[model samples]
Target chain A: MSETRQINVSKSQVPKLAIIALGIIFAAGLFVVGFDQGHIFSLVYGEQAFTDMYLHELTHDMRHAAGFPCH
Target chain B: MKTSLFIIIVLLSGAFAGLIHGTVNFAIVEPYLDQAIGIENQNLFASGEEEDTTEFWVEYEGYRTWQKSGQILAGMILGISVGALFGIVFALSRNALPGNNDVKKSLILSGIMWLTLYIIPFLKYPANPPTVGDGETVVLRAILYLSFIAISGFGAVGFYQLSKKLKDNKKIIALVGYGVFISAVFIAMPENPDELTAPMDLVNEFRFMSVLGVTSFWASIGIILGLFWRKLSSQKETTHYN
Candidate 1:
């Protein structure tokens, strides 16, 4: 009788969950740093956030340095 | 690799690389920013937009402090964002990438990404200091810049995918195709509407430092993530003898 050899191995699957999570991070972070202009804060603070522009002012230096549109 | 571990590695790598980029900007780019802001302040004063009083100086100092501190924090955030994209691409394309180790392959991808996503877009719309941009046209400029980046990136990708289907000897056509297409798009795009009022010397120097800051981020992410991926993937591949 001939015996068959079996090797125990695990194949990796495409990590969809991780990719989705990272995709969200990419979009959210890009917005906060690159082009907030008070829009994100406006979600909570109403129209006043546009004037405060807390995130925008905070990221002002970097936005310009990193080649984003900043006024 | 496990999902949680992969996410952790990608985020951490991005944060570290971004931190490096932020620190570099502090050392090399901050002075130019200060200089440009100084000119902006002078313009505001000259135009009677505000009186240069102690009160004004106090508010200015407060915001400048916030802006400066946020540089590092923002760098990390931006790092995580761009790094996420890098991680995703690296994971999917690892096998297709060339090299005996993950580090070399990671670096090659980073260079290609940096060129397609960053340098090409930058050439069409270079970084400008504060004084150079106009508030009225910011949205327009943003659209133009973003459009060009997308075109350059997708154009390169589309051509590359096509190359995979062609004979090896005919692969060079994709390269030529990308060059010609991007050149056409470059000419078609509108010039930055804002007039260059800042001193050419100041503008040019700031742009140079800006490029350096962004480049550091790309290089660090490539090395850091490559090392991490190699270590973890090796563990995953280990075989146990019963």
Candidate 2:
């Protein structure tokens, strides 16, 4: 008799997949948004708020890039 | 699957909402800045002649173009970074034991983090106030403060849940909490439809874009680092087991 074995996935894989998916989505979204200059302008205020969040993130990167990193 | 997709949509929407809020407030506040600075031209420097005005306007337009492009790049970077951070943190805490730490503890940790990282810096630099500048109107200011608190609060909870090894639905719950924090900005500062029709006469697109680009670039870096840390830890665990 031949038996079939089920392969179980770990919970940890979920987050990794989520992150990769997010990165792809972000990259794709930018590509689409980049083409529409008017839409980009129309979304300026929202964009600024986004920029504020990015600034905080970028500062973290700059520190790391400078070799003075923080978690 | 539905929940995960929903969470992603919510996150993206939050980012988009912030952009809209920022743009409108920027438009409104430019006039206020002009009034305060006593400059007839939207640009800071004004030589009182038609030829000077024409030259300044041309220079200003070029500057505005640069700024807008910068902002779009910044926004994309920031979104990816934040998403990556969320992913890594979630991965790391997938094994947290339930009821070991409650939401309250997470909030305290969040407060400490905020105090140490954000509040302290601002307090020390009190004189150098981090004004949103030509972007600070009454509505915008309120939204900014409220959103900061909300993001910090939810971010802490989400981080804590991950730390506790929560799985499946619990992770989504935590993400939803984070989403609420992000969405608070829009709830606090809804756009006025009437303002949309108002002339862009005072708005300098270039300056606006520059600020956006610089800010987003920085933010993406933070997010990427967080994700990297998680990925590294996970790989180490796999190697040890193998």
Candidate 3:
């Protein structure tokens, strides 16, 4: 009688979950760093008068330097 | 090496390479920006506007230092983040790709990524220097630039899907499909008609330097990751013998 080898399957799930989580976080970071040059923090806080161009200005040189459109 | 370990190695290698790439820019290009400010002021003066009254550079103090550090930080962030994404995609596609050496595969994929993501869009709308054009047209310029990226990306995907469906000459068909799609989009895309605000020579040089910087960064990441990955995998092999 031949016996079949049983493979453990549950161990693979962790990395997949981690990858998904990392992907989401990375995507958000990409957006915040690359795209959302303004109103991001204000949008998060739901504040009506907390407008700031600091982030935009901070990232301005990097944006143009990296070949992303800024002008 | 395990996939997770390999990814971490790649990410770190990529970040290190990116930091180097950023350092190159800070050393070479940052001075040009300061020069560009002066030239742009001259341009304004030539147009009969008060030269010193622009107040553009005056509004931003401490930018020189900020720009230097920011480049390095941005490079590291972009390197690791994009490297992670590359690892995931490469992991998924490894089976279908015809190569045993992961390094060669990574270089090939990096070339493709650079072409589609950066080169194509760059050719269409090269990187502009600070104060290169009218601020009013920025939104339109950005939209057009992003549209080129989307089309290139989708065209590549469409080619892949179409290649899978075709029985013969799949490569030819896919290439033709992608070529036609990109050409049509490129032709249809709106061009920025505004007069150049910065010196043409400066704009061209800055664009060239920016693209070269990105090319070096991606190339370094691919090479570094390849070396690190090979070492890690070899170590894993030896450990299994113990």
Candidate 1 displacement at residue B86 in angstroms:
0.6
Q: What is the DockQ of each candidate?
A: 0.45, 0.06, 0.26
Ranking by lDDT: 1, 3, 2
* lDDT (tens digit, per residue) of candidate 1 on B1-242: 67888899999999999999999988999999999999999999999998999999999999999999989999999999999999998888888788888899999999998898999999989999988899999889989988998899889889989999999999999999999999999999999999998999999999999999999999999999999988776433344444
Q: Estimate each model's TM-score.
A: 0.94, 0.31, 0.79
**What TM-score does chain A reach in every model?**
0.79, 0.29, 0.56
lDDT of each residue in B1-64, candidate 3, tens digit only? 4556755775687688768777777776677776776676677678886555536455444655
Model 1 docking category: acceptable
Model 2, runs deviating above 4 Å: A1-14, A17-71, B1-14, B20-53, B65-80, B90-118, B124-242
By lDDT, who's the top model here? 1
After superposition, the stretches of candidate 1 with alpha carbons farther than 4 Å from their true spots are: A1-12, B235-242
Question: Please, what is the whole-model Cα lDDT of each candidate in the order they appear?
Answer: 0.90, 0.37, 0.68
Q: Mind giving the per-residue lDDT tens digits that candidate 3 earns over A1-71?
A: 44445432212222575467547645764554455546676666555423454555555556677776664
The list of candidate 3 runs beyond 4 A from truth reads A1-19, A43-52, B1-7, B41-59, B167-169, B233-242
Best by TM-score: 1
